[model samples]
Target: MEFKMKTEGFHIELPYGRLDISGNEENGFRPYQLLISSLAVCSGGILRTILTKMRLKVDDIRIIADAERNPKIANRIEKVSLHFKIKGSHLSDEKIAKALELTTKNCAMVQSMIDSIEVCKTYEIIDS
Candidate 1:
């Protein structure tokens, strides 16, 4: 996990590959997107594990994040709304609610951003 940095135009040269980053949809992932992804996957993975422990059949887990950024102050993300779509069979609403609650309580990435960004979550359970 060590490499020389390419300082020309917000680029990084890693051993695996080179990353070209910017706010626009140009080449690589924007730094803010990475932050959002960390939170998304963190909750998704933990939720999956919890569902498995509860013996629920989970066909798929899709997580999407809607983030709002301020144009005035450094374009920092003011809020991140996470939407969770769980496709499964025989899933109960009570279990789903509890699972989401556990995800909200356990995700480290989301906790880390609590002081800076407002994190909101929602979920839906679908039959497989």
Candidate 2:
């Protein structure tokens, strides 16, 4: 991926569209927002696949992610908390927990930042 410099930051042309990234929030997407989004989406997608393979009918999956950043050290991300609200049928707590475990294990983004960032995952199964 090649990024071209813009007035505010940089823009990358992806197959889907163009993504603008900048330190200022008003200009475009922030770097840290993208980082957290990548991790959250990756885990959510993997969990959805795992639940499907387990034969659970999933109606919808929503993820809420919170991150802790330390300003003293270049404002680096210290920890990330992911809460998943899954709307489905015949979902058991045990199976859902196992699926979450598998998701964390399989998600490449989570694994990539394993050493540097602390990631916590929790879930709620909602009957639909």
Taken over the whole model, the C-alpha lDDT of each candidate is 0.84, 0.96
Candidate 2 overall Cα lDDT vs. reference?
Answer: 0.96
Clashes of 2: 0
Top-lDDT structure, candidate number: 2
Candidate 1 worst ten-residue window by lDDT? 1-10
Candidate 2: Cα lDDT at 82: 97
lDDT score of residue 79 within candidate 2: 99
lDDT of 2 by residue, 1-128 (tens): 89999999999999999999999999999999999999999999999899989999999999999999999999999999999999988999999999999998999999999999999999998999
Candidate 1's residue-wise lDDT over 1-128, tens digit each? 33333443366677777766665656456889888888889988989999999999999999888999999999989998989899999999899999989888888998888888998889888788
TM-score of 1: 0.84
